[model samples]
Target: MNSLKHHILSGLFMWVLSMQAQQRPNILWINADDLGLELGCYGNLDLKTPNIDRLAKQGVLYKRAYATAPICSASRSSMITGMYPTSVNSQDHRTINMTPLPDGIEPITTYFRRAGYFCSNGNSHNMSRGGKGDFNFLAENIFDGTDWRQRKEGQPFFAQVQIHEPHRDFVKDKEHPISADKVTLPACYPNHPLLRADWAMYLESVQACDKQVGIILDRLEKDGLAENTIVFFFGDNGRPHLRDKQFLYEGGLQVPLIVRYPDHFKSKVIEKELVSLIDVSATSLELVEIKLPNYLQGNIFLGKKASKREFVYGFRDRAGDAVENMRSICNGRYKLIWNRTPDRPWMQLSSYKKAQYPAFSLYNVLYKKGELAAPFNQFMVATKPEIELFDLKKDPLEFNNLADSKKYQKIKEQLFQEISTQMVAFEKNRIPEGEKTIEKAKASSLKYYVEKIKTHNPLFTADTTDEELLKDWENRLLKK
Candidate 1:
């Protein structure tokens, strides 16, 4: 009889554990690469993103969401680890030698797997493969399977769907082609016909991405998992454009964030509070009733008990062939950017930009002809200012610089002090990767860009002047 009682009690415990797992909400993260705040939901009237607009109406939309880093690898590293990339020595884009995460630091998937959640990382359309992690650190065993369908019966899941769209080599949207005339180009970029066409193509890529979002959401509802699942849709960084992707300007760091969980979060809410992309990991863990680790720098930014951030910080280091260090701090109203390497030009030698960005080429041509003016010409200078301050409320495009103005000196000094303090704190936990390692990486990147330029555009010879290059590019790029 005692033996029978023991068996019954063991069965009861197992049943209770399974029930607890079933009660937990499944977490779905739809991370879009090189996307920004150009969706229909974000008030861009030119773009047609019906699916994403509907999602925004059904959930909370964040207007002031910012990325911790402007580039992919560094921002992704921060997202997975819930820590600043600088702290883990993952600040550089595509580090030369990948290293294991520091002691006691692990990807968020580690915590989820420990609590009986099935972790998955996959492409938006297919769950089997083709997901982009691009983490600077060595991430092994971070996911159990590529799809949530592979999990056992009644098991909750943490799935990340990587949507690679809108990141250069943009395919024409044959179904819903956007007109160049309807698109509005940023003020900093020259208003040329080729640049307008490029902007329109980017919008088309965004529309295609919206279709992928609909597919993922539809599958969730069809499987009857939408109700018990928490959905987060956001970008890995800013949009893929000149003066956008690799820079620390507003266009580079600002991204759209939409969260949907009907049970816990209110619907149709527009959250204007400053939110860091890293907060996604912390908020997801909190919603699933997991205790946040003490070492995590990300704070929960959802639900009623959400923690509000006073300032959102960003860092840029070694993007492509350009080796530079820049930092920014924004308090929702004001922003300040500090360039450690002020001698480097904003238009540094980046082969990827030269090949992929038509507007970049146009800017070069226009600058040589002395057609570029004011704010647009600033980018073509030989060196950048050591410090830049802008009141976002007055100058959203960051065209006006107030760093040296007497009236704004107090505000500038305060922000400078805050950033200095934070940088010092970050240095305390920074990993030392040695100067030799960085030099080796820089050399390799420089060599690749120089070779790429020569091969991709043979007309760009040492003797080819700016005028000759412009005519050649226009003839090649402006063809129907």
Candidate 2:
């Protein structure tokens, strides 16, 4: 009876297709959680994402796409409202779970829904912002596993389908068939069996999401809504893990993005343009020939494209029961990091918490002794230098610190200036800089996410057992 009712409803709604007003094209956005460019199209050597790769062949694949915030909620929020995290007064990831939102940070769907487009989010409404949760426009549930083709013809629609796979549960490092053995891992972490197994599961999730993408595309074609629909597929942020999820590294912020509009766009292109998830607003809005809002901070990456950015910015406000505050600015050539807590370091938010995970403990030992691999030691364990500048051209892994080098003085000066300017702008948009200092980073992290995570710190080691201490730098440093 329920299935009959749905079919009857679908047939009745299909009748609405006869009358075609000057309505906008349908919008379908499929986003993955904690995903990067890990498909065949995005250069994931481990797996074959035939569907995602097919979409790339049919559309334009972005080379340098980025998430506005490395953390999920912040990036997701920015994409919805088309604004920077700081602009929304959401610069600090800690406040996401703490403070109430400022005005006008609501979902743009409210605006689109008001404009007569049927808006729905299938399944995962994994949004981090917008206090209004009561606005349900669907007849019953937007999360009924329906894609854009499921809608009635001639009725303009906007559908968002999200996938939350390959997240946290990959902790055991269990193998998932397809793997990342060829994919390089940072040196701060050691190569281990458990880690490999965990990564394989992560790959399996990507492949699984890819399979779902195939289903949606097939439906779009079967329903004959192919040409009129604009499809955008991407990740909410970089992968969810230690350095990637909570920290502002490329592995965290950089993601694969693709846009497809059959009737429009002439080029099957590869744009190395630096773009953030916030700019996704521009692409969506422009496809419908609508003017972007003035307040949106991101530049339009397509449709009368402008000069691409030199260096985009990323932030790490909080994650995994801890707040690891940081601000980073990256150009294709260089990157500069502003660690909010520059003094006290090495608070394990991921590996240490799960001490059984050797990646964390193993690196802990090497990092403390300043003996980790090139970029791992440079990026993961190099105690916060307050301001870190690296020539990305020379150090793609971001393993070098050129802040003190005179050889790259000009590059350093330019980056420093650019970062400073960005900081001021961010400050203006941020909560007032009160008397907060990094005096007790560890304590502050524990206090902030005290409720979210269980206590999972490493076993304290004695100074005399430095050799067998696993990776206890704090013991050696403070003689603990």
TM-score, per-candidate, Cα-based: 0.92, 0.76
Q: List candidate 2 segments past 4 Å from native.
A: 1-22, 94-106, 124-153, 171-176, 179-189, 305-307, 346-358, 365-375, 378-382, 432-480
1-480: candidate 2 lDDT, tens digit per residue: 999999999887655532332357878888877787677886667775888898888888888888878766677656776777766655544342334334545456655554556666664433322121222111133232244434455667777877665554443222335544564444434554445544555677777777778877887788787798888988888876555666666777888888888867653756556887887876677666555566667777777655476778886664434555678888766777777777636354532243223345546666677766665554454357777777656675565777888887787678778877877766555553233422243445444333222232334322223244333323322231
Weakest lDDT window of 10 consecutive positions for candidate 1: 461-470
Top lDDT prediction, candidate number: 1
Error of 2 at 342 (Å): 1.0
